[model samples]
Target: MTSIASTSQAPPLVLTVAGSDSGGGAGIQADLKTMLALGVHGMSVVAAVTAQNSLGVQGYWELPPEAVRAQLDSVLSDIGVHAIKTGMLASTVLVETVAEALAGCDAPVVVDPVGVSKHGDALLAPEAVDAVRSALLPVATVVTPNLFEVEQLTGVKVVDETGMREAAEAVLALGPRWALIKGGHLPGEPADLLSDGEREYRFTAPRHDNRHTHGTGCTLASAIASHLAMGDDVPAAAEKAKEYVTGAIAAGFPLGAGIGPVDHGWRQRA
Candidate 1:
């Protein structure tokens, strides 16, 4: 007789190495929620913890480098991941440690350069920015950065859509196979650019008139990693992720007092 565990089919496993958002809107919480909604098995390595709510991030604490390493080892040793997404490694040590651990992993990696929170609170330390650019970005399969982060990492401010190409070029120089520049901050239609230094793919969606998109970045990056785990190429994975996030943004509802989050369970609830 086949055991239940053996007979039951398991979904592709995607791992997220990120900070813990006590608010449950972004970071590891959002990543896992996005992965689950996209029909993937989600695992996590908590790199930091944030005392955050809808209003803003009040305080954050970084887990020690050794603790972060232990968590990564425990997950990778027994149940290997098909893909990885990283977010909000708060300190230089954490970033370097995560980068080193991921260096041995062969799965596709999505690096969400989370610099600030939805309410303009800093997530990653100012000094750690260099570590993310020099260490994490180089080993990423795709680096997803919004306009602020693009400027933070590359010193190139994206004032409009035309600056996206330059931002992608700057990010590609950091050694990632693909660079996904999120153009949601622009005034017109929301668009994202996925580039591999040789070719580019553009995904556009009608801008939803919603202000509760707190976790959109984390959600999008995790969705891409989830699709990559399911065997989609970088371009297809990004497009599907964008579609999923657009719907989520459309369905986003009010949470606490300030900005809410994208609805990860929009499909089931809709």
Candidate 2:
């Protein structure tokens, strides 16, 4: 047999700046898993460490701002990311630090604005909300906020799909290039609205009755970042991410004694 040279190119690089989920379901774990499933290389800069499981979060400790900045610098200065996703920035300082770091990067940024966990445990500090709104969101290429997160960030309570446009508009006022309002908490079919303050796109998917959707937010944001790294436009990335998460939610399996996680590798199983 003759020797052959390899011609495979390197995969797109995505970086997640978030907390560490001990349960391997959310935060950094979920981000990396979603990136891998989407055919992208994933890197992480953990901003906090959580004592979390399927049941709930017991406690979490935010990393020092210096450490978080160092990790971000180390990654961006050398490895360089094609897209960046942020979640669970527990404090104002960390949020500002990350925002400052990302302001200089040329890559697309996805902000998940995680305020609480699936079990209602607070993941972000009460004071950090201001920083996220003022600093972090301004630099975001796209901001993904669930209903509860929408209220936290913009005080827009979405009772039904009708209110999603208001929610997206409110988030867009904060300065992100685009806002994606996730209406998964509403009754009936799950729908998400993506808007750039000018054009709007709505994505709807059949609702899955499974309760094992612990990492849906993180997974969705990471998937969007992965698609952006792969060169998809914001609207295209959101559409693909919505499709991916819907399948993952449908394939969600129970874990531990409480809610489980969406299957990141659901596509492989199908």
Candidate 3:
């Protein structure tokens, strides 16, 4: 019998395609960190560059479409990602290219249709909204959008569980296989709903008084992608991700003058 030692390799590789966060709180930085913390190999393709921090996003510049496509081809042809999470792709051209590039790939995708930064600055461009809706969402395995993003994408406001149910349906109608509607902006306990156009799940956590709840959406999407790459199903991934983000929020740290980011290395430091 052959030992097969020549065929062995490490765990699955997870890729994060998004923007650069100079502050390292969210975007590619946070995604990579979350993947590392979860014991997975992390890779990144920066689609845009942002001078961002806990205070706010100061400025941004989208990468050329050809550059984005070249990066995607390079990664997909060689590294062969197990799962991919897309964050701030800033423009319609980049979004369309990313959607097309991942169209034939077999890996699952967690789409965090990020609109505004943790500090309330717009991340995606006006022309990109249509691209995200028509191109990207259809390709995503699981699309995670917060309340504002839900409204931005579907024109539905999630004020409560009932509203969330409606909002989830509206989001699912946009073409994703599954929709995870984050309800953190709603008053009261931290709540979110995950739906598959058939079954609906509610994830709720005790509202923490901590004002340091930045990078949460990015963290949750990355956690989900990591779990999926580790072989968890959509519901299972959602459960694990919810648990991870809950702990992250509970252990979130203050970094600047305004809202802080979720501590991706919380478990490591503890």
Question: Which numbered prediction scores highest in lDDT against the true structure?
Answer: 2
CA deviation > 4 Å runs, candidate 2: 1-7
User: Model 3: how far is 8 from its true place, Å?
Assistant: 6.3
The residue-by-residue lDDT of candidate 3 on 179-244, one tens digit each, is: 998888888887888999999888888887888887888889999999999999999999899988
**TM-score on alpha carbons, each prediction:** 0.97, 0.97, 0.95
* Segments of candidate 3 deviating more than 4 angstroms: 1-8
How many residue-pair clashes does candidate 3 contain? Answer: 0
lDDT tens readout by residue for model 2, 1-270? 999998998799999999999999999999999999999999999999999998999999999999999999999999899999999999999999999999999999999999999999999889999999999999999999999999999888989898998998899999999999998889898899999989999999998789999999999999999999999999999999999999999999999999999999999999
- For candidate 1, list the clashing residue pairs, or say none: none
Relative to the unseen true structure, what is the C-alpha lDDT of residue 111 in candidate 1, on a scale of 0 to 100? 97
lDDT of 1 at 234: 96
Better of 2 and 3 by TM-score: 2
- What is the Cα root-mean-square deviation between model 1 and the actual structure? 1.8
Alpha-carbon local distance difference test for all models:
0.94, 0.96, 0.90
Please say which candidate is ahead in TM-score: 1 or 3. 1
Instruction: Please list all clashing residue pairs in model 3, or write none if there are none.
Output: none
Q: How far does residue 248 in candidate 2 sit from its true spot (Å)? A: 0.5
